[model samples]
Target: MISPVIQEEATGCGIASVANIVGKTYPEMKAIANGLGIYADDTALWSDTQYVRTLLKNEGIATSDNEIPFTTWDNLPDTALLAIKHHQEDGKDFWHWVVFKRIDGNAMVIDSAAYLDSNTRTDFGEMTPKWFIKVSLLHESSFDA
Candidate 1:
């Protein structure tokens, strides 16, 4: 389980929230994600499935066939929930952290980084393979819990 303090910190401030916790800007976070082999582009075409898979693997998390099902949002696992909550609390949007775990039914969570700076809250939603891949590959790791 994620610490309550961390969770509160992440959910409290917007971009500045993560900046305070991780001591880095959104752009810097993108660079770190890119360095970890994760793509960090928001206006790209295809989803970065490989990049997201690589990041999960690097973090000791595993996925089947290097792909996360888009429909796994109905029942997300605890780990994924932790990840999403942490990222969301930290004000992450646009970018995303996708996770595939089987704890609470076979489901995935799409934690968007765009919400960090978005003026509206409708930008974030359920995990889709395409969106998951794109955001996962580009999501900043500096904010990872």
Candidate 2:
């Protein structure tokens, strides 16, 4: 099940996304990330896949990080943590973490950084996913192998 939307603070996108997937409050997850030495208080940056994987492990969830091409977007699971890259007006690739899921037959994205106060799903058509973390049960084996 997908968790409630949690707004990101500065570089909290990665932490917030991980929190949403693990059913933790943003502050709580931030604290955990900090204790794990993955959060940078000075810069408010938290973008470490290894740390994210450890967080999932602590929650009893098995996951694997993968770089997925856009052509395989349709193969993504209904609910997932996605990393999307888009070119900003500054002529640079801007990376953002977002939650991807389908609600009522419509694909949508829950981007805390985009709309903070609101917890609504937006159209995924505008997003360009570059990477994703695949979460699954411990006892299950991936079909990819």
Candidate 3:
């Protein structure tokens, strides 16, 4: 089971989500991001999409980013980083990041902010999948391209 870490602050959700998936502590990932000039006090809480990929790669994780439609959820790997667009009740639209795990036909979302209940099995209620970054922990030789 993956341990969940709540985003320390409102803007750190992206970093926090990635850290939680990669099994790193919030402070540890935050420090690396801070050193790379990616994390700012509060104003710069959101990370540039590409930079998130680079950060994962620098830590030796292989990842591929792609924009996939919500209907194609079945095509997603067992575990992936999902970018979802949600329309808030107040009429504002926001993009949130979460780690997705599919098991036994049930999809689970591991959100750093606990926006989702841990190990939730329900499909996307209001959130729509926009894109995802697939992470591979195995060596390149293990899988064929």
Best by lDDT: 3
Per-residue lDDT over 6-90 for candidate 1, one digit per residue giving the tens place of the 0 to 100 score: 1122322222222222335545544555576444333220122344444445544443342333444443323331223312223
Among all candidates shown, the one with the greatest TM-score: 3
Name the weakest run of 10 consecutive residues (lDDT summed) in model 3. 40-49
Candidate numbers, best lDDT first, in rank order: 3, 2, 1
Give the per-residue lDDT of model 3 (tens digit) for 41-143: 5432443466566667767777764545455667777777777754343454446677788767777777776455653434567556776777777475332
Clash pairs detected, candidate 3: none
Q: Where is model 1 more than 4 Å wrong at Cα?
A: 1-31, 37-39, 42-46, 66-110, 113-145
Better of 1 and 3 by lDDT: 3
TM-score of decoy 2 = 0.73
Error of 2 at 4 (Å): 2.9
lDDT scores of the candidates, listed in order = 0.32, 0.64, 0.67
Model 2 worst lDDT run, 10 consecutive residues: 40-49
Ranked candidates, highest TM-score first:
3, 2, 1
Is 2 or 3 the stronger prediction by lDDT?
A: 3
lDDT of 1: 0.32
